[model samples]
Target: MGKKDVSISDSIYDRIKERVEGTGFDSVDEYVEYVLREVVEEEEEEEEPYTEEDEEKVKERLRALGYMD
Candidate 1:
């Protein structure tokens, strides 16, 4: 993977390092990337949350149209 050196404050680096100690991450860089990617994936999956009620409505409609029993 391509990498670029990012400038972070010593305090911020220390914070990440502390978390890294017990997280099983090999390095601070890996932990940071994992967190960033998690945030991105969460945003991508952000949409209407389907529920059982919604599913039942569709099934009811299909039954009404003789598409299902």
Candidate 2:
């Protein structure tokens, strides 16, 4: 994919630059991509919605495994 130009605040940009130096990432794009991946994974985790049937299945499994009262 072609690169995109982005503008960020000086403080946030400095922090990304500092982290990139320790992480061996040579460019702002690379560091931003890594941070974006982390954010996406976190969002995916938050978006996992459990239905009523899913909760029931978990309760049954826990009972079968003797983890429930």
Candidate 3:
């Protein structure tokens, strides 16, 4: 596999190092890979929050359909 070097803050690097040791990962690269995978999973699972505007639209549709009195 190919590798790429990226720059990060000292604090972030330190935190990733800590996680690498704490999780018994062999290298910082492994820890970084795990973190990036988690971030992508979280982004995929995230959805827009429900809002009053959506509720109002649904209510209007229901009224138009005579489902509401």
Candidate 4:
């Protein structure tokens, strides 16, 4: 895969550098990539359709809490 360069503010870069100081990440770019991947994965998971069983469970909880009739 090819790589691309994206720019960030110097302060943000320094903050990420400080965050990864004692961790496994070797550079700000690596930590950013890892975080971006996690966020993308979460968004993808959230795109799945909500089914009727899911709706029923939510309704049941709401009813238990007296928010539903």
Best by TM-score: 4
Candidate 2, superposed: residue stretches over 4 Å from native: 47-69
* Model 2 C-alpha lDDT per residue in residues 1-69, reported as the tens digit of each score: 776777899999987777566445678778798668767976887777768997798788556534576
How well is each residue in 19-54 modelled by candidate 3, as lDDT tens digits?
A: 556344688877688668757966885785548997
TM-score of 1: 0.61
Cα deviation at 41, candidate 4, in Å, is: 0.7
Local distance difference test values of all predictions, in order: 0.76, 0.73, 0.72, 0.80
Better of 1 and 2 by TM-score: 1
Model 1: residues with Cα > 4 Å off, grouped in runs: 48-69
Model 4 Cα shift for residue 28 (angstroms)? 0.6
lDDT value for model 2? 0.73
Structural similarity to truth (TM-score) of each candidate: 0.61, 0.50, 0.50, 0.66
For candidate 2, what's the RMSD? 12.2
Weakest ten-residue segment in model 3 by summed lDDT: 60-69
Error of 1 at 8 (Å): 1.9
lDDT, candidate 1, equals: 0.76
Task: Give residue 16's lDDT in candidate 2 (0 to 100).
Answer: 73
